[model samples]
Target: MLALGIEGSANKIGVGIVRLDGSILANPRHTYITPPGQGFLPRETAIHHQQHILPIVQAALKEAGVTPDQIDCLCYTRGPGMGAPLQAGAVVVRILSLLWKKPIVAVNHCVAHIEMGRVVTGAVDPVVLYVSGGNTQVIAYSEGKYRIFGETIDIAVGNCLDRFARVLKISNDPSPGYNIEQIAKKGNKFIELPYVVKGMDVSFSGILSFIEAVAVQQLETNEFTDADLCFSLQETVFAMLVEITERAMAHCDKKDVLVVGGVGCNIRLQDMMRIMCSERGGNLYATDDRYCVDNGAMIAYTGLLAFANGVTTPLEEATFTQRFRTDDVHAVWREKKSLPLKENGVVNPGIN
Candidate 1:
């Protein structure tokens, strides 16, 4: 069986085709980039997706060497994203579903990332560190859900990075985070930034505020270079992420940690996580940008898993939301495990 998936939750729009055996036949995507010192708006981003979705879908099918008749199902990101962009993908999937007389599956954006990480890295039951432009969450499967162990109390780590890049007037062509990662390599100074980790949850708004309020002026004064700011921000936020992920792993008694999401492609973040995992005698599982960044292939593979397990979205219920929580999905595809013992002040009723 083959499935076609569309993803336009944020600035990126992707179309992918996947076989039932977890093989990605085609995965093509385009990102809606803004000028330096600017960020993408939801309305404009949605328009970009609307303009490119059809062509991207066509390109995916052609590259996959498949016909519309061969596709058994349709899938799209259903939530936890910009409403307008989510609607752009959802409407296209609905149209395709009706036109092709195929089934539809509404996949959670975050779970798709985790499932993609699992399939790509062969990680089994690993704690997930999901970091993206809009979300920062530490999660793991428990009972019938991908339980959220921790998350951002305010702005996400990626958003903080992107906004700082805007202040620095860095290019957003590939990604703000990626550009920051590149320039950070040249940094020699480690400007101490606010490090906030409240229990398992992290707060980046204060850090962002500090840098925006102080670091920008310091950059003009030549007290620190832009590279130094980037380096300091990455180190501060990634350390918080590593701390929470390790804490979640200890809480769940899991030996493996998987990083998934757009920001998960950061080399420094991966290095820090690897070090943390190694110190705990565990493993760090991550993928390159092709899989780590949001893509339709992840959605297709995840929706395929759900479809195989007797799940499908009805036309009337084919909807998207901006506030869909990760724990709300009833991940019926995985087997339920017994609860774990409380650790570090966290009570685990199941294996999260």
Candidate 2:
């Protein structure tokens, strides 16, 4: 079966067409570059989504050489995203589903990230570390469900990065995170920062405030370079994530790791994660831009899996949920008692 997926979770509008076998026929993204001082104001972000949603979807359909009638299912992000953007995408999906008489599936945005990583890496049972604009958590499949082993107790990782970038007057031109990464690369010194990890939950708010104070002090005394501060900040935060992930792997007895979500695209973080995984005699997996960042392909791929398991939401039942959790969804993979021995690697059942 063929499915068309629409995603407008935050500042990006993505559209994709995918086959049931997990091949992406077409994938396209429209990014909204927020102006300086905008700072995620809901009204401004909503306006951005209104302007680009339809065009991106149309472009994806044209590129895929398919029409609404040709698509067997229509899928869209149900929630765990910005409210206005979710509404915009849902309105379009509702209309398309009605017009084409196709079944519509509502998918959780976080689970889509997890499934996308699995699809790209073909990892049987990997410990998942999801870090994005709105979330950060460690997950694993167990007892017929994806369980959350640990997560952030306060602000998200991406949000913290963006806020710090704004404070530094870094350009949000291409991407705020990218600009932060560039500034961080030029950093040469290590500045002490707050590290808050309560039990299995992490917090970044205090760290953000501390960084701002340091920046203020440097400005007053003309004492430090922004690059050094940026480098120190990234190192401290990324190390926290690596520490938690390592702990989760040991607790869960997982030998494989998959990193997903927008922040997963960060090269520095990926490098740190790879080192941690290697030390544990395991491997780390990451999705390319196609799946790492928010996109329609992951949403469609996840929706297809949900649909196959007899899951469907009615038009009236459709509603946006901004705080959906990964553990809320049922696991599609089932652990088998007997492991199959192969020349390549250990294989698990229920995943193609």
Candidate 3:
């Protein structure tokens, strides 16, 4: 079966086509490179989506050597993203589904991240650590659903990083997150910062404030380098995430851990998580920018599974949700035992 997926969640506009057998026929990706001077203004983002999304979608379909009529299923990110951008994707997918007489599946953005990690890692029951610009959480598969074990009480990890970058006048030209990652590598000294972890939940607003205060103080003294501060900030935040993820694995008795979402692409964060998981006799799985960052391929891959299991959204049910959760989705695999976990937290090869 051929499926088309569209993702216009935040700043990126990704379109892709995939077959039922988990093969990507064509994946055309694009993002609005917001100028560093303007930052991420929602109105400007919406305007950019309107101007660029369609062409990218058309290009993907053309590259896949498939006409719109050949698609059997239509899928798109349903929410947990900017409303304007989400609506832009939903309207296009909805119209295309109607015109082609194909079934439409509204996939949760976070669940897509989880599914993509599973696809990339081949992990049956890994503890999921999803970190992105708009979200940060620890999740696990339980009782036929992906459940949220713990999450951020306030702002997301990547959002905190972006805000911190802005305060330091760091460039957002290529990508705000990429710029911060580069600056952080040059940092040499570790600065003491607030490390707050209330049980499994985390808070970054306080940390951001503390960093901003330090930045201001350093400007007055003219004694601090932005690189050092960036490094310290990344170290503090990533340490918190690793702590929580390790805690969740211990609590859930899971030995395999999967890291998803945009922030999962950060080399430093992934390296830290990998080391922690290894120390506990656990395996860590992470995605590269292709699947780790926001994209339509994940949505389409997830939607194909959902459709095969008789899951489809009615045309009248078309609507965008701003706060969809990964745990809200029901498992769509063919067999329950396919995701069996051994007592030692390893997948049972005999089960599937």
Give the number of the best model, judged by lDDT. 1
Question: Mind giving the per-residue lDDT tens digits that candidate 2 earns over 1-352?
Answer: 7788888889888988877667787779888887753466656777888888888888988988888889878899987888888888888888887888898888889988888777667776898999998899988888878899999988999889989888888877767777788889988889999998776678999999999999989999877899988898899999999988888999999877899998888889988999888888998888556678899988887787777667777987766777777778775534322123121132312111
Evaluated against the true structure, the overall lDDT of model 3 is: 0.83
What is every candidate's alpha-carbon RMSD to the true fold?
6.7, 4.5, 4.9
Clashing pairs in 2: 80-321, 187-227
- Predicted structure with the largest TM-score when compared to the true one: 1
* Cα RMSD, model 3: 4.9
TM-score for each candidate, following the candidate numbering: 0.94, 0.93, 0.93
* Model 2 local distance difference test score: 0.81
Backbone clash numbers for all candidates listed: 0, 2, 0
lDDT of 1: 0.88
In model 3, which regions exceed 4 Å deviation? Answer: 334-352
lDDT of each: 0.88, 0.81, 0.83
lDDT of 3 at 208: 95
lDDT of 3 by residue, 78-155 (tens): 988998888888888888877788989999999888876776567778999999999999999888788998899999
Output the TM-score of candidate 1. 0.94
